[model samples]
Target: MRKARWLIAVLILCAGVALSQKASGDDAADRAAFEAVCGSCHPVSMASDLRSESEWKETIEVMVKAGAKGTDEQFEAVRRYLRQNLTNVNVNTATAAEIAPVLAVSEATARDIVKRRTEKGNFRTIDELKQIPGVDAVKLEARKDRIVF
Candidate 1:
């Protein structure tokens, strides 16, 4: 019975790892598609300026109208990637999970941001956010445009 239980646990662990890997692979492909489609006309660096979902959708529409070329699958992948990884967040109102991906911060640091906000109230400025311990000031500065308070 113990051996059977151990085998079951190992199978579950393997399945979890496999799923995670597949998700990561999908993300990588999506990112590549975004770069290929967007890079055709403008530098991919320009995309680092985070936008809202509607804004990204509109931008993609404009680009397509203006002659950006990609398959429907590629365009969809690009859209999904942008929405998942590049969209902005309202830090004052956003959950830790939302903040973590947008700001490229760890979950622990994101939780700390929530804790600080809970204790002291909403953040009004970059300087205020920079004051949070364990939060990277430079990274915050780099993504300042993506942050809304």
Candidate 2:
């Protein structure tokens, strides 16, 4: 059944292409969702790719409950989009530029954050950002990803 084998191969090839397209479609959807909503409050490049599905879900919930006005469906979309796009591994030190965009803080403030962190030496954990005058626990959590050592 040479004809049957050929048909099966063609179908398999088509299926593979469809699967790739579906993955890319999901990425496009996530990017669109993030751009439409999160773009207002957060700098597009400020936040990290993502940590995990659950992390994104919880973070979105926190933002919405705090003041963000996106619909539940929209929020979910944002969460999914962020989760897919923003998951990073390096977490020890941070740059002022990286910290500034996410916190709505000034470059001066970001420099201060660096200064304080430098003075204190390496941070043993994320909570140490609180030692910086203008930084607080919530703010630290927000920028923890960009920080290391």
Candidate that scores best on TM-score: 1
* TM-scores for all predictions: 0.59, 0.46
User: Each prediction's Cα lDDT score?
Assistant: 0.87, 0.64
lDDT of 2 at 40: 72
Using alpha carbons, what is the TM-score of model 1?
0.59
**Which candidate tops lDDT?**
1
* Number of clashes recorded per candidate: 0, 9
Query: Candidate 1: where is the Cα deviation over 4 Å?
Result: 90-147
Q: Residue by residue across 30-130, what tens digits does model 2's lDDT show?
A: 78777777777778666555454445667767766767776667766776665334633222355675555444457787788777767766657666656
Q: After superposition, how far is residue 52 of candidate 1 from its true place, in Å?
A: 1.8
Weakest ten-residue segment in model 1 by summed lDDT: 46-55
